[model samples]
Target: MCIGVFKKENFEIVNNPKDAEIIIINTCGFIESAKEEAINCILEMAELKQTANCKYLIAMGCLVQRYKDDLIKALPEVDLFLSIDEYDNLWEKVAKLIKVEIKSKNTLDYMDRIISTGNATAYLKIAEGCSNRCTYCAIPYIRGPFVSRKMEDILEEAKKLASSRN
Candidate 1:
């Protein structure tokens, strides 16, 4: 859903900071190692922003969902912070950051205007939010658990994306 709402070719996905302008680091906070990786990514992006004239640095995904306040303060250079729960609002958040209003009543509508990877790939989110009460994990607490997408809805989306691309 998120990937389908951006002009993908407009941004080069790179692990190296030397070749990109905007860096949207989808981070993971599921474990200590993941946290370290996320921090390292932020630091690298910050350096690139300083020396390479990178215009925007956005952090999203699980790391932000887990450490929203800390990430905001620690990486002051980060231009935007998007939590996991905000996956559906990716376009809105990005539009606000770039100061451009993409007129759309729904995410799918917004996706039509935006160019996805422009490739033959797409992600279909079958469900949103998790309801597990695992203590170490924050997803269930933050997202409130899963409500499965109807089989028909999933099939419909898959068929649409596949057929359109084909």
Candidate 2:
């Protein structure tokens, strides 16, 4: 979804962090090890601003959602930090950073998504978050309450994905 929006805005998506002007990392903070790994990755990418072409380093996802305040203080190298719930205005935030005017208000349309995976398969998200609130799981906390997409929206996205392959 993000990649699609970037493409729509004419931003070149680079494979390597060293070559990128803006680097966005979607991290996972489900467990201790994952949190450590995400921190390490963010630190590593933050180094690129000095050593490479990277100017703006943006971090988003569960890690940011969970530890946004701490991360901001701990990692001053990052230019922007966004949580999962902020995705609705993702393009707006990005546009502000890049100094680009938003062409559309509804920039998060699922149909605009670019399948990063191979052509053989595409991921279709039917829902978000979990409501179970299991003791050992942090999903309810990290992702918030469960909310399923409407059947019509799911089917429409499925059709979009299916037709995209052809």
Candidate 3:
């Protein structure tokens, strides 16, 4: 939904992180390996700030919320870290960093999504975090409780997803 959210604010979502002026990695830190992978991914994407078109290196999602302090100290390359809760204000923060005026603020009706995955497949995240208390998992603590998105929004997104093929 990050794509949908940012697109609402008129931000372009490019195919390559190298081509993007703003690169946001919405991560999942459910498990140890996932956390490791998320960190590795951050390190990987952080490289684009120098070699690529990336200017705003943002790390958002479970990892940010869970380990905000440590990651801030560890990864100085990351321009900013947005926790799962802070996603609602993503465009505002980015706009300030990029020095661009927001065309339409407070509109969450964006359904246009850039197909990032290979082939025709796409991943649409309907909800974030997990509420369930799985003893072995960190999603609840890291990502917070699971909340279902509004049914209307989900249907609208689905419609747009189908229409994109046409």
* Top of the candidates by TM-score: 2
Worst 10 residues of 2 by lDDT: 100-109
If both were scored by lDDT, which would come out higher, candidate 1 or candidate 2? 2
- By lDDT: ranked, best first: 2, 3, 1
For model 1 the local lDDT of residue 12 reads 44
Q: Order the candidates by TM-score, highest first — what do you get? A: 2, 3, 1
In model 1, the worst 10-residue window by lDDT is 106-115
Model 2 clash pairs are none
lDDT per residue for candidate 3 within 1-166, as digits (tens), equals: 5677776666677777778988888777667888899999999998768898777788888878888899999999998898867766777877777788876664234465556665466566688668888888766787668888788888887777776753
Pairs that clash in candidate 3:
131-146
Off by over 4 Å in 1: 8-17, 105-124, 160-166
Better of 1 and 3 by lDDT: 3
For model 3, where is the 10-residue window of minimal lDDT? 106-115
In model 1, what are the clashing residue pairs, if there are any? Answer: 129-145, 130-145, 131-145
What is the per-residue lDDT of model 2 for residues 27-141, given as tens digits with 9 covering 90 to 100?
9989999998999999999887889999899999999999999999999999999898899899889889878777777477788888888787999999889999989999999
Please report, in order, the local distance difference test score of every candidate based on alpha carbons: 0.73, 0.89, 0.76
Residues 52-76, model 1: lDDT tens digits: 8578889988888888998888789
